[model samples]
Target: MKADPRGVLTGTHFLDGDHACCEGALAAGARFAAGYPITPSTEVVERFASRVPKVGGTFIQMEDELAASITLQGAVWGGAKAFTVTSGPGFSLMMEHIGYAAMTETPCVFVDVQRGGPSTGLPTLPAQADMMQARWGSHGDYEIIALCPNSPQECFDLTIQAFNFSEEFRVPVMFMMDEVVGHMTEKVIIPPADQIEVVPRRHTRKAVEDYLPYGTNGDGVPEMAHAGEGYKFHVTGLTHDEHGYPNMTPATQDKLVRRLQNKIHDAIDRITLLEEECFDSEDVVVVSYGITSRVAQRAIEMARERGLKVGKLRLITCWPFPEKRIRELAATTKAFVVPELNLGQMVREVERAANGKARTFAVPHAGGSVHRPEDILKVIVEASR
Candidate 1:
């Protein structure tokens, strides 16, 4: 596939988390970014604000996170791939509007560079504490696509994937990162723009008179036409019908909600991505994500040298949890160790998927740093014995 001249190509080079994320959004063909400057995640907006104009895109720093998020929604409605970046507090402030994005079937990317949480915990420190919140931060029942990156390269790559998924599914995709990945400097070789595959938002070719904003075909995803592109359509948070008009009727609400929810939920097999190493023969599995995956991998290698039957399942996409794979591994593995920087946010989902068959344990670290390999190895050894 020819890379979009606008996309980032593959290679290795060192870059800070924020820069790589900005580059990823650009490579994904994002033409607009609106965000507020918050610690840890501030650099993401700073970099994007400076670079977006160079690519003929718009980047605005709103007065606050709430405004920033809603601005991104407007940008997406205007026919541009849009995004925003924030930390825990800012993310909290954006939750109501995030719910609005979800309810409206808006396609946009939200990059949350997590720091210590619950008010202003730690501005510069890293934390994976936002895992559960990312899944249910909003008020209603909705599905989210979130990707966590362990390295600067993965940060860039996954940011692009987040945009693609959000556009394809018409949902808000969160690019979940920590201050560690956000601030760390590493070499990241950006591929030539021509090598990146940028997925554009699906548009209907029908005439303006024939367009239906929320009308669905076989796939539950409604064909969307950009505003001002000759398609007069209404978009609101209120329950509506296929034509996008306001409909307070319960039947219309049920049908609209079910279709919106099913469009992504039913495509679980297609949306979830996981990486399993030494999965077949291993009796013990170490499940990890983000920067913690690196520690888990090292622990697995050390355990292997000590004659321990340990493997790993590294989650690339955190949301729409890989329940099927977790179940399969749980059926065979003796125990599963989940090591994370938080006090066990994602482990709950792992346990649920394990269905009591696999004994799940969590090795958690609070704010500021990642779990060391030795700590994870200790858990592995204990589980093996």
Candidate 2:
């Protein structure tokens, strides 16, 4: 294998998910990150701090999670590819900044290595309780991209995708990883930089006089103008217009907010990613994501061994919830079995999308560990029947 001129570590190696996440950010051209130390997630930035300097990147240890979250956005406005990392309470603290990122249309990433939650629940344990929070943690009417990785390799690959989505949509992206996936060690194959595809920031080419900070370039997403670029533009968390000025009128608010959301909602098909196994005529479909998807696989196999027609849908992009696909499957499948670390967060989405067409069963766990294969199998068996 040839060395990557871009300084990416291009090869296969045994690495835990947190470490692999750092490598992914690096490979994706993330040159700046701000983070505060937090369990199950600190390692992502810890590795980044150590490894980034060699690749011409910078990692700042912020005073707290809020600071860490906002700082990365500042970095983005200054023309750097940036992200931040946290878990549980830290993630909660960053909600305000997350909303600010949304309102300002900052292109950045936030990695949440989820542990058991509800305020300092379990620091070292695994849980998917943050799924809803990732979608709605910040108040308001906005859409954000979120990717769930069930393995170390995905941790590497999806982090890159996370940054790319942030750039493509000009929105903050949530890279949701449970503690199990964060700490679990596995082989990760990182290809050469030349093999990697990165989306460059959509910087405005129009003259400073011609640029509107929030103006679109055909696509709903506005072209960004970095600070110190001889272009003048304002950014605020409040409702703003094409010039990025704060405009509190209902009409301005309506137009700005709708554009912010429609840019994502309209392109849902392109943003969603899933790994699926279909049966010719399946009786049930098992829906899962992150580490729980791995556990669900075992349960799926157990049900299959018993001659059950159980299909699988593993969510790679959790947000922009794949309701269309779920609704389509609802028409044909008898039931949907969702097994997740939290007590039925995503199952609610499944239930809503199913719209009573098919029965829905949620196999929920409290999050110290993953669910037993037999427990999920029982649900799948029940759903099949």
Candidate 3:
């Protein structure tokens, strides 16, 4: 379906990532949001709360991050495309509900404007440290889509993708932004409503009598019925049968859990997104994402001027990790230099994918800010040699 013309802010304007994300969500048909304001991410829901009423939606400022996180899920089951925004501490509070969203096959979006942290480390500064936490913070076994936006332009573009992926796969999609991207202002061009294609919810066509909440036609993703649809269905976080009834059996566990993981695992190629530059020919590839990708671009330019065969791989979708691409590059590139705001999280994924076929270097930062071009260039030079 095309976006609503009324909601589409069709024009070019200077905006920051958080505001851009809010615009993207509105443009993509997100009519509901529940959030607790925190650090850099606060602007997202702030904009949503102010703008949503005009567009026929609801925005709730929950008492806490925990309420905000799960309240969005309730909105989703009630038949609205919903999302929430938070920073490090709020994100941590939302972990349990993230797992709940996964277990119940709830389609929702979680925006984490990452700040340096274990608890409340540098609440107003940037960090990519949450990369691992986004994947593993929720516990149990499941996969979720995670996208990183380096610019306000991408921040707008990728939030739509995040919602689409969530609806299509019936899974939570993580919109991982950093404090730098969230606060940094840039030009954002929002296109006309007709130009934007949106994925509508795959609501079931089945009659209420025959509907099985957990029943799949063929694909792993089951059809959904809204709460008031009279579908007579059930959904729970425990292991369940096709009818969505809790069943304490190994057979149910194996089938349900395996299918949940396999839906994403099998579609990794389609879900994975990367922005590549000269990687096919360059002996050294500098891999980075989010704000760090922009920083790495400068290093790539500097290395090229120095007559080095350096390439750039900017991860647009960080989770689902682009292992195949990295593995293929491992056979060609001499080394992979990963620069991140964290000490080294995603660099480990690059290294694991590269295995022993190529050397991998981590250019880590404890976060609070971005990496300097020279620091990444230094790693690129070393990797090239």
Candidate 1 residue spans exceeding 4 A from truth: 1-12
Clash pairs (backbone) in predicted model 2: none
* Per-residue alpha-carbon lDDT of candidate 3 for residues 51-128, written as tens digits (9 for 90 to 100): 999989999999999999899999999999999999999999999999999999999999999999989899899999
Worst 10 residues of 2 by lDDT: 1-10
Tell me the spans in candidate 3 whose CA falls farther than 4 Å from its real position: none
For residues 1-385, what per-residue lDDT tens digits would candidate 1 score against the true structure?
A: 3345643535676789888998898888887988898999888778778877777899887899999999999999998989999999999999998888888899999999999877899999988999888889998678889899988888888898899999889999989999989898888778877767677888888888988888877799888888878887788998888888899898998888888789988998988888878556577898898888887898899999998999889999898899899898888888889999888889899999999998898898886777788999999988776
TM-score of 2: 0.98
> Compared with the true structure, what per-residue lDDT tens digits does model 2 show for residues 28-127?
8899999998998989989999988898878999999989999999899999899999998999999999999999999999999999979999999999
User: Model 1: which ten-residue window has the lowest total lDDT?
Assistant: 1-10
By summed lDDT, the worst window of 10 consecutive residues in model 3 runs over: 277-286
- Candidates 1 and 3: which is better by TM-score? 3
lDDT of 1 at 381: 89
Query: Candidate 2's error at 293, in angstroms?
Result: 0.6
lDDT winner between 1 and 3, please give it: 3
